[model samples]
Target: MYVAVKGGERAIENAHDWLAEERRGPADIPELSVDQIKSQMTLAVNRVMAEGSLYDPDLAALAIKQARGDLIEAIFLIRAYRTTLPRIGHSRPVETDKMACDRRISATFKDAPGGQVLGPTFDYTHRLLDFKLAADGEVPEAATAAPLQGDMPRITEFLNRDGLIQTETPSDEPPRDMTRQPMEYPAGRPLRLQALTRGDEGFVLGMAYSTQRGYGRNHPFVGELRIGKVSVEMDIPELGFAVEIGEITLTECETVNQFHGSKTQPPQFTRGYGLVFGQTERKAISMALVDRALRWEELGEDNLGAPAQDEEFVLSHADNIQATGFLEHIKLPHYVDFQSELELVRKIRSEAQANTLKEAAE
Candidate 1:
């Protein structure tokens, strides 16, 4: 992975120096702190954490500061840092149904079980910029309400009761860990979900959007989309039981698709799931759509020959870090490669002229 340049050390060092200066900006204005970024620029931090496959807000904020607000660069830094940390033990699967939901909405149903909680959404707001922030950073306090009460059962469960949607077949086999092992295809749904959750948001969103635009159409309705904090539990060897390690905010999405009938099974609704870290509703919803699209074969649905349906294509290119790394390598000095190409072109041109002159003489 190391590319050595003969006399580029001083140039590289100077570039680093200039980068640091640019990151700090003007000396007159007060410098921003990691804490301020951690607290204030919450969505950006969450995105870094999600894409970086790390959950530390402080680290994400620090990376953002170091990258000068370039989120992809921040993600690259976080991913590199994560490689140095030692692995402990795997945590139990998060139960999102028990989540302390900050926002929950369903497009398919009029009112879901727990009712619609529109917590802190920009859905109804006008897109025009609120110039009040340019003058001063003050705002009115938000109204508070009592905690949401009731069992947060999944909307798919209702369809499942009527045998309208496919039921999940329980498995004792441990799902593959893509982070621990090298990615191999054809990957199962579990492995694909792993990649999708940590995949680049923009790419996944675009792929999902393409599906809506008639490529591998899945007539998906938002069964439910909820964002909130859920407790993370880990099984302790010493304690011989699982303990609540901490709480993590997450976004879970479920999409309901049109009914389909096959040779063995009757016509039933299909469901798509997306469970991701932080309150990334857009990514979560996109993930659900793509996840369903990828399940064409498993669901006994016909392959519509769409990009989203191709697991290898989607999973391989979804990582922004890998993509950026490969693309950025071209920026490095390629003098020798260029010189070889230049010589080849010159030789080809010279041979062509010689042949043309010989033909003219004849």
Candidate 2:
């Protein structure tokens, strides 16, 4: 007695219209401009670009506006748009040593080179609401200082000189692109790092927290965290030299973990690394912790079967778009499935009642 619902197209159109209206809010209020979002909501735009795996700030801003401030939706829009663009030659890896740092800090040392600059951070800010911002939305300019000169050396380099940490040999092999190919188990470190960088911020943060709470404890110390701009370069075959293409803001994190050594090897402090687009310290630190957790096998530590240690689980469920789609699909029409279940239930009850009656009569 069931009839399939019709007029799906009309329903969808109406729903979209209503959504558009909701996005605009009242007519009296000025509609938020993409430029305004790009400037004021820089963090949101940064997150979209980072998770979207695209470095375009303008597109990220547009996506943010179109998504009605939903960061995940903005990331989805950016990701979708990224797939349509043609891929040219890849750029050479950026050099963090030459970064023009705006914010830099280290927990392991009180004073380091470049001198621990704290630029535009909310770490020490009072949590009270500012009514002045609500009325005029104007922020007063803060005092400035002279910029630091020369390349700031990494804290790990100091340890490296003394042979206090494991030496990592550079590999020239190109990394596997997860977008172009299906993800496989036992993924290389580069693939895992890429997955962690683009993974849902909250999901990655939670996983990192779990490790701190004894799930896969790695005893991490923030060796250094830096935010800065670096020039991107691409090698030109015709020119016979690499040329600077553009500059991008990036956040880099290096975590010093517990020492791991055995009878065959000398004891040395371990390291975990994270690098991502824009000034996102939380994601960067979380990424580093998770990276170290995943490196347990190679570091000669026990697997411990923790969630963060499980590469497949972490990478597969990290994408909010994929997770949200599968989760939200449950709301769709499932009339056929429900009908089948209903009939099965009725048949089972009827048989049970018939058996009871036959037993009584006998």
Q: Ten residues in a row with the worst lDDT in model 2?
A: 144-153
lDDT of 1 by residue, 1-362 (tens): 23446776788899899999999999998999999999989889989999999999999999999999999999999999999999899899888778788888899888787788888777899999989999887899989665454558887788888888888786788998887899999999999999999899999999999988888857899999988888899999999999999989998999998856766557888888898878788899999999999988876777889999999999999989989999999998897897788889999999999999999999
Off by over 4 Å in 1: 1-7, 146-150
lDDT of each: 0.89, 0.89
Per-residue lDDT, model 2, residue 326, is 93
Clashing pairs in 2: none
| Regions of candidate 2 where Cα sits further than 4 Å from its true position | 1-6, 146-149, 263-265, 359-362
Assess candidate 2 and give its lDDT: 0.89
Candidate 1 lDDT for residue 238: 100
